[model samples]
Target chain A: MMSLRLQLGIIFIMLVVAGSIVHFLRRKSIDFRYALAWLFVDVVIIILAIFPRAMVWLSQILGVASPVNMVLFVGLCLSLVVIFSLSMSVSRLADKVRKLSQEIAIIRKDVFDGDNRVREEMNNIKD
Target chain B: MKKLVIIPAFNEEGNLEKTILDIKENAPAFDYVIINDCSTDGTLAMCRRHGFSYLNLPVNLGIGGAVQTGYRYAYYHGYDIAVQFDGDGQHSASYLPEMAERLEETGSDMVIGSRFITKEGFQSSSLRRLGIRYFTFLIRLLTGKKITDPTSGMRMINRKLMEKFTEEYPKDYPEPESVVTVLSEKHRVTEMPVIMNEREEGSSSISLGNGVYYMVKVSFAMVIARMKR
Candidate 1:
């Protein structure tokens, strides 16, 4: 049978692995421009997963006590989830902004060209 | 008054001759500059045949770029008034004097040929009509001015406005957005009642997907315009 300490570590590792997997899958549809942000988020998760003690220290500084271990573990897990969610939101927003800019650039180019192709395409879209 | 008409022509081979000839016959006093947007058709040939002043762009630039080029020419050459003429034949030259007179009387920097100023026939697609309505709402909200036809290319601007418009003109379907531009610059923009004829030849380039794209793009631009000091 695994010791309590090893069991806790295994659970932590599993949780981190599952989260990373889900995050990777979820973010796969995002644009390549957001790769750096997602990568940084993944790196933070990896660091937090490897050093559970760091989380304990953080909890202590935040005034978490009485069932210190439990509180720290839950706190760390919640913090990681929030961070991941925020990173995903930011990545998505970045993609939206980039798409907007590119569309503007193409339209801007078309205006000067006088090809009327863009206008025709827009008319067709309206129909 | 020495007036120069700036006509932005893009793939307008079909209507170029007639439009130019009409302008020549009606407003012969007004010298014209047709900005050829690297037309693949016989648009340039028509300009040459009519002996109209023209500038051929190396590559096709949309209405915004072509119009801005005209403005730049107007600013540099010292044109008293610059009128934006559409090569698509939607605008009539007969209304030029009336539109110009309105601008002169009001001391307005820009004068727009508004179809809604009177009962004018608008032949645009229904979706475009809705888009124009939305744009009209947006402009009124932003500029505190009730602009009926925000996308009319038949407009006139004086030397002062020509200088400013030449400096920075909106690219990509600029007509609707230009009201915001002129308003933000604290320039007076007035609209005149004028009827527009339907585009006679060549299909418009705007598509549904492109329309959605245009909406988002212009919305973002409006936000930026609002944020400007």
Candidate 2:
């Protein structure tokens, strides 16, 4: 069982994290998906803090001798998931940037050169 | 045929003038578009002064993205052939006509201008030659085809392959990976012997510091590309 002091500390820390995430969500400074993920993590931690017996049960099911070990295990798994998602976001962003830059360059060349032949080329792309 | 040479230049201002001049002198019939990949040098200015056709990317997309941009231009402009001509002055424009002719005559999807076929011109540093040999062997093991010079920047592709390139191109050291891609898809790829001049100025993109990383990335990409349908 978690002592009251420890549980209070956990709840206070999670509250701060949740507050920051919500603030960013309202300001639109952070992506909605990422904000939601952070909030979910906060809620999970809060639940474990509030019900230490739940953590004990989870630890038992996971074959972890101590609830502290279970907490570390969960934290490690979540971090890996977050890192993988970040990699995916970066990859997608790079692809979009490359495509947009390529299109902008071609459009600029057509307009800058001022050749109807280039315009004809633009129309040819549509075909 | 509407052939367009795609010269992707990144800080190659010193070498670009001669490359374009060579193209004009040797392959004047083919149209060209210089893909200025956000060069911080005088490459764009030189292109403007010379009145050369060019596409200036607002952001630097590296060699792969720059060349792919040219392929997109070739695609949108209805070009019959698109040739990847390096702007570093290492590749000669004299080979363009013969490469395109081989592409047409042999009915191949792509034709690569390889120096190893005749062992003529500047054979790269021995270390780099070893790397190219490894890739050549790996590609053979995977695709059952011999690609003497897998790293050659001088290559010509028919409209079919050009269309494929516009849709998607490998962003990482694309040459060997793309060759595996085409070969896996069962495209007819041929090699034409050509003399290549050593890079006139600047340096090759793969240098000593990142040589190992380059080898690992390219090898992984080739194997993955080959495994894909």
> What fraction of the reference structure's interface contacts does model 2 contain?
1.00
Candidate 1: residue A48 Cα off by (Å): 17
**B1-229 per-residue lDDT for model 2 (tens digits):** 8999999999989998888889999998889999998898898998999888899999989999999999999999999999999988888888898888899899999999998989988999999999999999999999999999999898899889988998889886899999999999999999999998888799888899999999999999998898888
Report the lDDT of model 1 for residue A112. 45
Deviating ranges (above 4 Å) for candidate 1:
A1-127
| Candidate 2 residue pairs in backbone clash | none
List the global CA lDDT of all models: 0.74, 0.90
lDDT digits (tens) for residues A63-98 of candidate 2: 889886666677667767777888999999999999
Q: What global local distance difference test value does model 2 have?
A: 0.90
The TM-score values for the models, in the order shown, are: 0.64, 0.93
Docking class of 1: incorrect
